[model samples]
Structures are given as C-alpha cells and as structure tokens.
Target: INDTFGYQNYFGIIPIFDKENLLGTLVIELKSQQNDYNSRFPELLIEGKLKSDEDFRDYSFAFYKDNKLYSQSGKFTYPMVNTNEFEGVSNNVVFTSEDTNNVSYSHAIRKYDNSKLIVITKEKMPYVVRLATLSFFFLVFILFGIVIYILLWIAKNLADSNAGWFNINRYLMINANKILYKTRIQFSVVLSVVATLLIVGWTTFSYIKEEYLKQQKDSIREKIRKVQLSYEKQILNLGLRVDDTGELQFNQFADVNAAYLNLYDINGKLLLTSLRKMYDYGILEKRMGPVAFINLSKLQRSEFLNPSEKIGTFTYAAAYAPIRNAQNQTVAYIGLPYYANEADYEAKIGLFINTLINIYALVFVLIGVLAVFLANQITSPLTFIQENIKRTKLGQKNQPIVWHRQDEIGLLIKEYNKMIAALEVSATKLARSERESAWREMAKQVAHEIKNPLTPLK
Candidate 1:
C-alpha cells in the first residue's frame, strides 16, 4: 500500500509468489503505531513470497498461525486471515526478489512525506540570530559615538566663541568709559546679568530639546519595530513562499505590506533589488558605490540594534535599520522617513534669541541715550557758569546769569551776583576817597604857588 497522505496506516499487503503469481494475501498488522509501518511492509510481502519459482507457480500463501505456516490460499483465490497473527513483525523489514526475466529490483521501504523534506531543508540551513544581534549592537555603538563626538565638538566651538566675544566686549567697554569720562559700571553689571541669564536659558533649552529629541527617536524606533514585527509575523503565519532565485521581493498579506526590499553582496554589489527607480538612475547608482553602501550598512545595523539611532537633522527625524542575512551580516537597510514637529519650537527659540539680541541692543541704545542726556544736563549749567566767570574776569560784569530754576546752578548764580554787588560798592567808595585826596593836594599846590609869588614881592 502506498502511504500517499503520509499517515502511517497499513492496508492489506500483496504477496507475489513469482513474477506472474501475484496474489492478495492476509491482513498486515502493525506491531506499533509509533513506528512508520506503512513505509516497509508492502515491499517485504511482495518480494519475500515470490523469491522461489516453484512456490510462485503453486502460489500457496499462508498466515503464520501459532508459530506455524497455515495454507490459506489453497481454498480461496485471495487469502484472508486474522489481522492479529502478523503483530510481531517490525516495520523495518525489507525483501529482495527477482522478476520473470530474473532481474533484481529494489524499492525503498520508506514513507514519502513533503513535510519531512521541508524539515530536512530547515535543519540544513540554520539562522545565526545571536551573531546578528551582536553585530548590530557593535554598529550601533560606533554610530552613537560619532554623534556624541560631533555634538561635543560643536559645543566646544560655541563656548570658545562666546568667551572671545566676552573678552572683546569687556575691553571695549573699559576704553569707552575712560574716553567719555562716564561711569559705565551700572551698565556693565546689567549686561553681565543679561548675558548670564541668556547663557543659562540657552543651555537649559538645548538640554531640554536634546531630551525631547531622544524621546521622539525612541518613539519612532518603536513604531518601526512594531511595523517590521507585524510584517514578519504575518509572513510566517500566512505560510508565504517566495520564488527560488533569491530575488528581493515583497509580499503583501491581509494586513501587512513591505516595499523596497534589496539585497547586496559582501563586495557591495547589488545582487537583487526591489527599490523604486523614480529618481536619477545613473547618478544614484554611481553615488551609491561601495563606500556609500558600507556607510548605509553601518547606519542600518546601528538602527537595528538601538532602533532609536537617528539619522539626518534633528528637525526631521529620519532613521534606518539593517536587514541581516542568515550569516549575521548586514545585507541591506530599511529607513523610515519622518518630519519632526520641532519647527515651531525651533522658530520659538530663534525668536527668543532674536528678542534677546534686540533687548541687548535696546539696552545699549538706552544707555547711550541716557549717558548723552545726563551729560548734557550736567555740562550745560557748568558751561553757563564758566562763561559768566570769564565775563567777570574781563571786567564786563554787565551781563548777569539768568537763573531759570532754583537748583545748584541757581544758587551758584545768586552767590556770584552778591559778590559782584559788594565789589562794585567797594570800588565806588575807594574812587571817591582818591578824588578827595587829589583835590586837597591840588589846593595846597595852589597855595604854595601864591606864597612864592608873595615872597618875590617882599
């Protein structure tokens, strides 16, 4: 009997006494269902009973009864016996026989099952899952290191620039204060406070943004993982099979779909691809050479391991993961494109920075305006006082200071007027006394002249 369905159930066997004496014989009983009995029993019955020509011609088939061969084929054209008598026979028995032409033939005493063939193939090709995992992690570490190094370098450069600007501004402020003869200490203090606040605010904002980006990266990675996992599960569950030529192809299931699957060799040659050819084919192919392929592999492997590993700018969070082969090698990469929602946030930050700059500029402008106003207020009165003193020195005290307000300048002008008044009174008194003395001297001179004249007459 042929086990066409691969279910081990033994049917009645055919016994061949000779090449021409083929006869249906007793029912075959399997010793144990645990063994694959259907695989070997029919061949043994066909070849063993037909081994001798004389027995084949007579064609006497028997069931072994009580450890004795009992002829049952003599009375009936087809022999029939108890199914229990053949129980002790193992399923593995084989027989060799000759045909009418004395040609020997052998058939394999085994059951044919497609499932067994599939099992054998699966066993022969093992997937190295652990090695693939390790390789992915290693690439992830490398990519993460590169990102960290770039961030640190940027931060260092910014710090250096800020320090240089601070030093230059400080020096300029000192020199400007000296030339203007103005105390800029209060302005410097205010600027220092503003700078410190701005620095702190920027640093805090950066740190917060970095954390948010990290979280978003993790979320995107989780989404990709979920999508891939669902796709893989669907593929396995649906018993999908691909074409044999190792073509990179995608199968769409009831709820899952994948696209752009590609395969590359170790030398970075494109073996098979299912990518869309919408872009510039020549330029893309030329630019996607071995180096680009390797870099993409690394990035993909990193993303596969950490999934959160991001690529492209933070403003648009795009990332990739590796497609690994059974040999634990990165064969290809899969990428998910996403637009980060940070545009508004970035714009806000930019606006904030601009606002700060504007505030600083306004503060500087205000300081300059205040300095000029105060200087004018103080110097205008001093200039008026100085001009009045110059008039007094020139003996032109005709013009008096017109005091408009009762401030310090008004009081100075009042004291100056009182001094000028006292000087004028003293000058009048001295001039009168000098005139009297001159008149007395003149009178005495006249008397002397007269007396000289009288002496001449005597």
Candidate 2:
C-alpha cells in the first residue's frame, strides 16, 4: 500500500486460496513506530508489530512478504516474525552495531515462528552528554565534600587543638598524664597526613577523568567544519551582502538553521545575535581588537570558557568563523555554538569531584581508625612505665614495671629497679653507722662526768 506520498509500503500480503485457486490477496501493513523497521518479503505473511528503543528517524522500517520487498513502516505493525533474537529472549535486546543497520542504544524484537521485526528507540548517549553528566556529579561531590570536610575540620579543631584554649594551660595539664589522650593527639596528627594524601589523590583522579572525557575532538571539529561549510554558500551569497537587519533573501532564512548565531562587524562590534541563552553577552559590549579573546588563530578557532564563578558552572566550548562577502573580504565574524548541552560538561566535572570527595571521606575515616590503633600500640607501654615512676616519686609502693618484650624499654625498667635497690641498701647502712657513733659519744660523755665528780670529792 502506498501513502499519499506514493511510496511503496511494507505490506505483508497473504494470498487466500480456494482449494488451489487464488481468491484474493490479504494485505497487512507492517510498521515500526520507533526505529528503522527493516525486513524483507512481499506476500504470504501475517501482521506484526516491532518493539525497540531506537529513534525512528535513524533507519526506515521494512518487512519481507514471500521473499519480496514491500512497503516500509516507521513502526513495526505487521506479522511474519523471526524469533531467534526475540522469540526466546527474556527481555529487550541491547543493540550493538554489529547486529544493527546503524548503532542503536536499545531495541526490541519479537519472533513469530520464522520472522521477526526490529524496533529501535534511541541512539547511545553522545560523549559530551556523558562527560557533562560525570563532571556535574563530580563537581557536586566536591562541593558537598568541601562542606563536610569543613564541618569535620571545625569539630576536630575544637576537640583536639591545644592552642589558646582557656585562661590557663588547663587542658594540657588535665590531659598530661592520660594515656588515651596523648595517644589520640598523636594519632590525629598522623591521620591528618593520610587524609590529606587521600583527598589529593581523589582530586588527581577527577582531573584525569575530566581530561579523558575531552574526547572526540577531531571528529567534533570535523562536524563543526562540515556544518559551517554546508551553510557557507548562504552566508557568503546572501547573509553577508545584507546588513545586520537580515533583510536579504538568505539572511532571512538563517534564524532557524544557525545553532549559535552572532554577527560582528569588521570593526569587531557585535551587530546581531540569534542566541538567547547568552550569559557572557557582556563580552560583546566590550570592543574587540583584531584578535578575539579566546581564539588561537585570530581567524578560526573555538575554546572553552567559564564565564560564571558559581559552583557547577557551565564551561562552553564555542567555535568562531569568518563571514565573507562577494569581495572575499572578511566582512563579519560569526561565532557558532558547538555544544548546546553545556550543562552536561558541568555535570561531568561535578560528578568527578563529587566521587573523589566521597572516596576521600571514606579513606579519611579508615585512616583515622588505623591511626588510633597505631598510636595506642606505640604509647601504652611508655604510659604504664611513667605511672610507676610517678608512684615511686610520691613515696608510694612502686610495683616493678614488667614487660614481655626484650626491647630497650624493658632493659630500662630492669636497670631502674636495680638502682632503687642499691639506693635502699646504702641508706640503711648509713643509718646504722650513725647510730653506733651516737652510742660511742654518749659513753665517753658519761665517763667524763663521773671523773669530774670523783675529783670534787677528793
């Protein structure tokens, strides 16, 4: 069946038979609403439908009827289906270029005995879109991470910082002897370094991801050139000859075709613009010199610019071209907007930053715990020995500091106990000797007193 356009439709035709004689031809139109409906055959087929996720504009739909080609359908709505990829398929098929006429993201196929129809919905997401998505998430993560980091930093500072605390050195004096307090301080210092490294590592990862997503440059540039070249005739023939009013035949038709249209006079003053989403339009107000602000050749170039300072801001990669007149003189420069989807780039950056921040947060937490355990292991023994020394100084019964390890600390405790024993013994000897000397002096004094009494009696 042909539509009003007189195009042959993919009509599945089945012949009605009276015993063996042909009665009439039963025709059913096969159609695909989404992807290019492609199949082959002409007559003797049933009506069917196509299921796919690919866009309909990409490929046209077709079906086979008795091995003869018939009308094509944009939507699969005919019969006679091959079920190999779909008859037993549990779910919709992910389209690969290897199995499709063109690349498709996802497609649906249903089998009816020996024949199947394809329906595609949409194409795979372009690199710019994906990059922008990741960048956005990364940027968000970075910002969120910064906020969290600042909060944690403030809390930690309030808790651990020993600087300018109270009227006196009260905090230091209070925590001076507590083993856990000293350990925690030391652990915090170590963990801070580890956390810094992790965060820097995360930042580095985001930068690398952003760089990687700056892909398809040659292809993208080629596409830009082709688009510009396609519109070159109109620009030169009519758009350029007319003034900024766009009164000429060609200039009048350009408002819709151009993606990012900006007209600049030879003197570098902006004359007209078709772009409405212009945030950096202020640059147009500023008089431009012979060289453009971001262009490299001072002739034809494109570059990325972040006009705004806001977080998750857009970084647009815009292209510039020269509009020439009949005399081949550079009459005006037209700047074309390459990527209409500026948010994707921002999103990609954001995502990259955000992912790293989250990872760094997790790593910071893990490192903090490790730092505490490590600090405790290194400080606990020294703290115990200190306690014993304090006891000894306070004239309290000091228990021997015992340690299992044959390290330097163990030897120190052993020698310290020996010194204590030696001092005790020497003090006892000095006391005994002083008592004997006192006794001898008393006896001599008694003898002297008795002799004086005898002399007085005589």
Candidate 3:
C-alpha cells in the first residue's frame, strides 16, 4: 500500500461478482497513524541490544537496512564485513573479531529476515586503561605467599629451636648434581625458599626497570634541550618579532614529530601557528605566559596519540625557552616538545614485563615440584636417626641405624652407633669382674669350713 500522495487513508475498491455476472461494489478504508509504527520498528529491532551487558547497554546499537547501514550509535566501529561469515546465521549471533580500525571487539549481531535489516553491538575490553599495573598487584600477592610459607616453616620448627635455646638448624636447600637428584631440606624449608625467591627476584626486577626508565627520561630531556639551544642561536637574530612565515619555519626546525608548537610574544599573547590544530589541546591555555615558563616542571607519563602513526602514551620532556635580541630584553618563547619511539612500543614493553613475571612464576613452580622428591631424601634418614636414639635411651635392644651416605647426616648417625657399641662393651666387662670376685669369696668360705673340721678331728 504505497501512500505516494501522503494520504492518511488507504482505500481498496472491489467489485462483487457472481458466476459470470456483476452484482454490486464493495469498498474498504484503513487509517494510518502518521507512520508511528514504522518509525518504532527500528527500536523494536534493538530490543536484544538493550538486553546485553550493563556496561554496553547505553548507546551501543547499529541499524542496517538490508546490506547497508542506516543508523548507528555508540562505538560500533567495525566495517567492511565479509557477508559470508553471516551466511548461515538465522538467529542472533555474538562473536569477537578485529574491526576495520584493527581493534578487537566483542560483537553481537542479529538479522531480521522479514525487514532485511540488522542490529550490531560491539565492545573492546583490551582498550581499557587500568589505573595501575596488574603485575605490581601480582607481586604484592606473591609477597603475601612468601610471608605465609615462612610463618608455617617457623611455626613447625619453633619447638625444636626452643629445645636448645634457639640453636640454628642446618641450611634448608636441595643438593642436586648435574646428572642426578641427591638431597634436599625438609618440605617446609623448600616452600619457604621458593616464596623468598619470587619476592626478591620480582622486587629487584621492578626496581631495575624503574631506574632504567628514569635514566631514559633524563637522556631524552637532555637531547631535547640540546636541539632547542641550537635553534635558539638562530632565533637570536630574528629579535622575536617574527611573522607567520617565520614562526612556522621555526616550528619546522624541530626534528621529531612534536605534540605542539606555538609562539608567544613578550606579552604572552598567542601568535601564528597551525590554525586547524590550534588550541585543540588544553595545554596552550596555561602555557602562554612567562610564569608558565618559570614554573615549567616536567609532566609525568602524559598520554599522546599521533593519528598519522599509532603511538601510545609517550613520556615526553617539554621545554620552552625565551628568545631575546641584542639588548637581552625578553621577546618570545620557542617551545619544542616531541617524543620518539617505534610503532607498538608500548605494547612491546608491556609484553616484555609480563613475560618476565611469567618466567619468575614458572621457575617457582618447577622448584616447588622438585622440592617434593628432595624433601623425602633428606627427611627420611633424619627421622630414622631420631627414632633409634629414642629407643636406645629407653634401654630397648635395637639394631644398628641404616643409612648410606658420606654427607654430614650420615657421619652423625655413624658416630651415634659407635657410642652405643662402646657403652654396651663397657657394661659387659664390669659384670664379668663382679662375678669373679663373688666366686673367689665363696671358695675361701668353703676352704675355711673344711680346715676347721679336720683340726677338731686331729
């Protein structure tokens, strides 16, 4: 029903007919509500869009009118879709793919076969900027683990240490030769060592990284100053009363692609510069006057993105120097600010740091696995020695302690076994001597009784 004439009613006329005879005429009229239902059709199609995650609920919809986009809201920036990916899609489909912008996005798309339209929603989780590094938080968690392990180790050995008024124990470590596993400390000791290594290794790496970055920043600032001073020599001849052409030529003197370049007169009024890019960044508002130059402190981790080249937040060293003439009077300030790095440097640095953290984690895990086998070798013999000593003290007959090693623990068991043998031999000799003395006394008594009886008979 084409309402080509912009009419409010759609009229249909039909002729009532009998078999081969016309009888009467019938007519029907339908009113249109000023295309309200048609206008609301787009909203109806977006019901699924609103029923998504709360984070993407607002302004995340795109409307397509059969193979072409008609309207879009929010940041649904994917384009150049291969229709083949949606060939078999009859119902709503959600997927993740890189957009034309080369940013990975989670997309939710639905096709309306009846109207030949589609609605798509997209979200990019990787683009989020965290306030702090997750690696640092992970380091904190590792430190907590170290504390727990050490506390447990200390608790288990507290009574032993107290017995000898805090006597030091043997070194807790695993002794492994190149080709074979040999010996190790108790299980608790190995756990404590692993935790300690993680904390110390991570903390040292973090400190080194911070220092390296600081040195890099300083080197960059020094280089920027060197170049600015070189240009300042040329500005000395111009007397700071330069025209638009001179100001632009001055801006071109900088080597790197700087974030901003502008000239200000002695009174701090804005002069000639890039009109299209002028004042877009709020940096120029406060950096116009002499006070700004005096109070010029360095900015920390300022974020800058170059449209021509994808460069992430670069740590920049900005400098503004006043141009003077022969009289040494203040004239104008030449501001040179720039940064240099290859594409994707930020992502690379992040990857490198995370890789280091992961390596540390993996090494700790390997050490933990090795600790189990090594603990048995060290603790088992020590347990045997302890049991043998207890039995010997209780006067119970016991076989010799069994151990095969040339290590300190093996030597200790050997010495204890020798001492037990020496004590047993001494006890046997003393008992024999006492028995001999008793026999001699009995023989003397018998001889005395027989001699007295013979004397009485004579």
Best by lDDT: 3
Query: Which lDDT tens digits does candidate 1 get at residues 1-458?
Result: 34322234556665756667756566675533321222222122234534443233223233333333332333222214433322332334333222323322321222122111100000111133334444445545766999999778556655884555566568668977676323343445456656776687688768866776677667767766665455444335542233543333342321133323333344455444343241224312412233334556544435532222222233334444444544545544444434333543565566556554545444544554566676666667877788877777432345567898998888988988888887777777877899999999999999999777865566
RMSD of each: 34.9, 14.4, 16.6
Give candidate 1 regions above 4 Å deviation: 1-283, 286-301, 304-319, 323-331, 336-375, 383-451, 454-458
lDDT of 3 by residue, 61-146 (tens): 55554455454556555344435433325565645454556655555656645334445555454422221245445556877999
Ranking by lDDT: 3, 2, 1
Report, for every candidate in turn, its global Cα lDDT versus the true structure. Answer: 0.47, 0.52, 0.53
Q: Cα lDDT of model 1 overall?
A: 0.47
TM-score of 2: 0.42
How close to the true structure is residue 392 of candidate 2, measured as C-alpha lDDT? 75
Candidate 2: tens digits of C-alpha lDDT, residues 231-291: 5667665455445456333344443554445556666676655532243434234233333
In model 1, how large is the Cα lDDT of residue 275? 35
The true-versus-predicted C-alpha distance at residue 291 of model 2, in Å, is: 11
C-alpha displacement of 250 in model 1, angstroms?
8.3
**Candidate 1 vs candidate 2: which has greater lDDT?**
2
Query: Residue 313 of model 3: what lDDT?
Result: 42
